[model samples]
Target: MTLRILILLGALSAFGPLAIDLYLPAFPALAQAFGTDIEHVQLTLAAYFVGLAIGQLIYGPLIDRFGRRGPLLIGVVLFSLSSLACALVPDLDWMVAARFIQALGGCVGMVAARTVVRDLCDPTTTAKVFSQLVLVMGVAPILAPVLGGVLLAAFGWPSMFIVLALFGSVCGLAVWRWLPETYPADMPRRPLGGALANYGRLLRDSSFVGNALAGGFAMGGMFAYIAGSPFVYIELYEVSTQHYAWLFGLNAAGFILLAQVNAALMRLRGPQFWLMRWVWVHFASGMALLAVALAQPAALWPLLLPLFCSIASLGCIMPNATACALARHGANAGSASALLGSLQFSIAAVTSAMVGALHDGSSVPLAGVIAVCALLALALTVWTASRD
Candidate 1:
């Protein structure tokens, strides 16, 4: 049963990254296709993030009110249709809009999967399962770009969208055919009023906000990497896009491996202890990386080493921080999971956009954003821990 849930959760979580990364190699092709600049091509990514952030919030309430199956099935249907539209679009504006809708649809799988996990398990189990899910997510970004490059090379930018559409359809069918409704009958049934009340209570709890923010900043630190990596690797080091895919995959593997370590630790110590330690790990890794980046003589080795350490930091923080947040509202899993997931992506999108806006195509901007985010996250984690 845990394996079944893990597979479904992984597939659902992978949707967001797969949707973005699978088409990344086509950035130049897309810019050319629409007669736009590179910056405009990046807007497509930002728009998708915005849609994902908003969609998770909406899906949470609907799932709680109507049950997971209905809202989830509807989301996959919309996701598939929007993906088809993305493939067929004639211009960049059309592509961006379609991508937004696709993200909106795709986020349902993620929100539902998290809510479902909370419904079925206790906090310890939630952290462990979420660790396994991250392993699967780590795979998508690793392989998607390679696959995207091949698709773009053989056919065109649109072909990648076709592949993604097919992926969504397969996932949708799996959910409809096999996934069970996990909401228990005895669990407190909540409508909008009840959901609002729960949210109010969670908002008043500092530990919930603090832990969620720790994870949120970890995400923001990651965005600094995402916004800057292509330039740092491809432009500065002159690595080929195909090679960059492999490089990117290696970093993701680091995330996967470390998350498993967190899962193993959870079997003994509390999630809070692991989360507090990881927050410091994240802060130290970021500062070390930033120091090396700023002291650079423009060597590739200096960049990759610290960057991997910085990414590995998340492997420790993400699952534990999330476990703490969702642990607070076990009774209202769907709504709580929704707000938690929504806040994560919303902060991520905003931070990623900030990195984009402050971009000068240099390593400093990326490292600076990471340091600030990590430091703030560490402080909040400490504060959250002491009170708890």
Candidate 2:
């Protein structure tokens, strides 16, 4: 791949994580800014997941019709504008609303970028490429929060949104200037009914649904950690918000480095082997976490260590699961990619919300949710493998 193309795809992947994570240090501040509770501020994060889920489904068909350029350009522009709106909002409600809009604007890039990768390579290669893709994707989550912490200390929550706005704008311009349109002229623009019908069919396909759920549940478990960790780390463990940023960034660094390892392993084992092995490891992680949660630590450090291991394993899960699901159906890749993304985000929102709702200012709640999700994903993966 051209360095330029890789960068463009990587940036496109980065926008979602950057949009969500960059504002994390601002979470507590936003609660204070609007005279709201921390739980209310958290709902804003959940709202973004809802928007991302809904937007992914819409953009899937739209990209198939319009090709990747127009929809992607539009999404990035809107994402930038929404970031500014979020920065300027006077109340919690307004911030929540703006975040939803920002998520909508950011959704197209993810779907299109994955579709574009699949277009350029076949399923197995798609898996290999995504190992690299995710390392690029990992940069945002790894840095955004640390950057958010710095921005928060220097400029406050409002300024964080401004940084987000600036980030979005820079990405938008880079996309417009540097990225080539990959969808071919010969690609058919399906009618709305045809697109819907295609989605309906894929949803019914047991194998597709199986892989999709295997991936979605795997991500939902991670998203549960994402949604609940700020509370658990900062509130329960009583870590400083800035320190939490550093800690969050550290785990992402683990993910980034491990993704590089997964990429290298793909050369030897292939996507299928690596993914199967990863799922088994995750299943074991779930059991380990369950045991840890039951043990109930007085200090957070021990639990935190293994938790990082599980989260890091997603380095193996996300990219491989995605590439496997997008393997066939090149004719309807946009819709397939879209639905896969939508289900992942949608499942994540629901799972995260459950964790948020159940938050008890203790590690048990977070650990319980994570373990359950991991267990379910493990069951599904095993079932899928046995069927074949």
Candidate 3:
């Protein structure tokens, strides 16, 4: 792919992560502003995940039927509008509602970007391209918190939403001008029933379902971290907002670095081989994380170390599993990508909400949730591989 294509796709994929991570540093401020607990503030993240999960199902058929560009433009415009709505919200409930609306629009970019990759590239090439996309997506987490911290310090949390609105507007304009419609206009448009049948067929495929579950559960652990870290780092560890952003950036850097390593390894080993191997690593790291949280909750390093390893492993697992799943159903790439994204975000949403709901003013909820997700992911991968 050309640099321009890579950049556009990367920017498109980064929108969700940017939206999620950018507001993290402001969580404490948001909770303060709304006279609510941190958990209630965290629900906003869960709301976004819920939007992403459901909205992809709606957009998948639309993209496949009408082609990619039209659905993408509509989604971005909606995202920008909802972002503005979020900025204008007067309370936590309205903020959560606005976030859901924002996610509904923002999720289109993720599904479309993955679908476009499948449309343009073979499976092997798709894995590499996804890794490249990860490199681009990595910038969001690294910059978002730092920028959010700065913005929160300067202009408060509402300014972050305004910036997101501007970002959505710019991305929408870029998609309009530059992103080529990968789905052919002449392609047959399937009826809604046909699209539902396609999803049902994908659900029945062991390889696709297995990889999707594996990826989704692995991502659930990451979402648990996202939901719990603000409390752990800020309240428990007493880190400053700037310091927390740096710590978050450090983990994100590891994730990006390992993603590049996965891309290089893809040149030498297949995605399945690496995916199976990393699932084991992810499981071990999760166990280690739980052990440390149980044994040394007071020491920050013990927990942070294992958490970093687990998240880094996820960076390897996601793109490979995604490529593997999409590779199996090239005939229905849009539906496949949509299902994959929906499952992942759904798992993430559940875990994030659970972490918040189960918050005990300690690290156990976070560590325990991560361990459970890892074991489940590992079991699914093993079961799927055994079936093969």
Candidate 4:
């Protein structure tokens, strides 16, 4: 991929993290504005996740049938319009509805970005490209919260949505001007039934299923950390919100740094080799985290160290797993990308829920959930290796 294409894909892939992180600092203000509690406000986030999962399935076949650019442009329009609605919403229910719409539209970029990469690159290059994309996308988590807080203080929480609207609009423009249709025009279009059949076939492929699920479980562990970290840091560890933001960013930084390193090093060793290496690192770190939680250490560094490692391991895991999974499905790249993305979020939804449900005012729930996800991921990786 050219630098231009890489940048565009990176921007596209960054949508989810940006959307999720940018509004986080405004949660308290949102609760107050809607005359509701934090739990009610959280429904909007849940609604977004639901939309992302379902929307990918909806877009997969559409993009495959009609091609990537048209469906993608429509999705961008939907996202922009819904973001505007979110900014204008008068009630919490309206906000929730709008957020769901936003995610439904925004997730097109996620599906299409991966599809585009598969359309353009061979498997090895695909992994390297994805790693580079991570470097671009990874900036969102580090910057969005601080940026959102600044926007909230200066212009109010609604300003954040307005910014998102602008961001979507710019993305749409970029797609229109520069992004060529990567899906081969001469390729026969699939009917909806055909698309569904493709999904079924994908599931039946042991290598595809194994790599996809392994990636999903690894991603689940990351989301588990994101969900549980606030309480674990602020309440249990007695870290202030200000300090907690820094801590979160530190972990994000680790991820970004390792992703760049992986991009460079994978060329020498291959993505699969490093992928399995990091899988072990991921599982070990999770076990270390569990041990730290169980020990109830007086200092927070022990827990933080393993937690950072667990998150950082994804720097290698995701790109490799994705490259491997979609490698054989270039004919149905859109559908393949959609299923890969949807499965990831599905696993993430489960693991995040586990953290919450298992919460006992300690780090154990968070650590245990991460460990379980790691174990599942490790098993899946082994299964994938055996199948190969």
Q: What digit string (tens of lDDT, one per residue) describes model 3 on residues 178-253?
A: 8888874556765666888889998999989999999999999998999899999999889999999999999999
lDDT of 1 by residue, 203-256 (tens): 788878888888888887886677567666776677788887888888888989
Question: What is candidate 1's TM-score against the reference?
Answer: 0.96
Best model per TM-score: 3
| lDDT for residue 55 in candidate 1, whole number 0-100 | 89
Worst 10 residues of 4 by lDDT: 37-46
Question: Residue 132, candidate 4: how far off, in angstroms?
Answer: 0.5
The per-candidate count of clashes, in order, stands at: 0, 0, 0, 0
Off by over 4 Å in 3: 184-187
- Per-residue lDDT of 148-266 in model 2, one digit per residue for the tens? 88888888878887887887788888888988778866777866667788899888876677778888998888888888888778887888977898889888887777777887887
Off by over 4 Å in 1: 193-195
User: Per-residue alpha-carbon lDDT of model 4 for 208-258, expressed as tens digits?
Assistant: 889999999998888778767766776678875556667877888888888
How many clashing residue pairs are found in candidate 2? 0
Question: Could you tell which candidate, 1 or 3, scores higher by TM-score?
Answer: 3
Q: Per TM-score, what order, best first? A: 3, 2, 1, 4
Ranking by lDDT: 3, 4, 2, 1
Please give the range of 10 consecutive residues that has the lowest summed lDDT in model 3. Answer: 184-193
Cα lDDT listed for each candidate: 0.82, 0.83, 0.91, 0.86
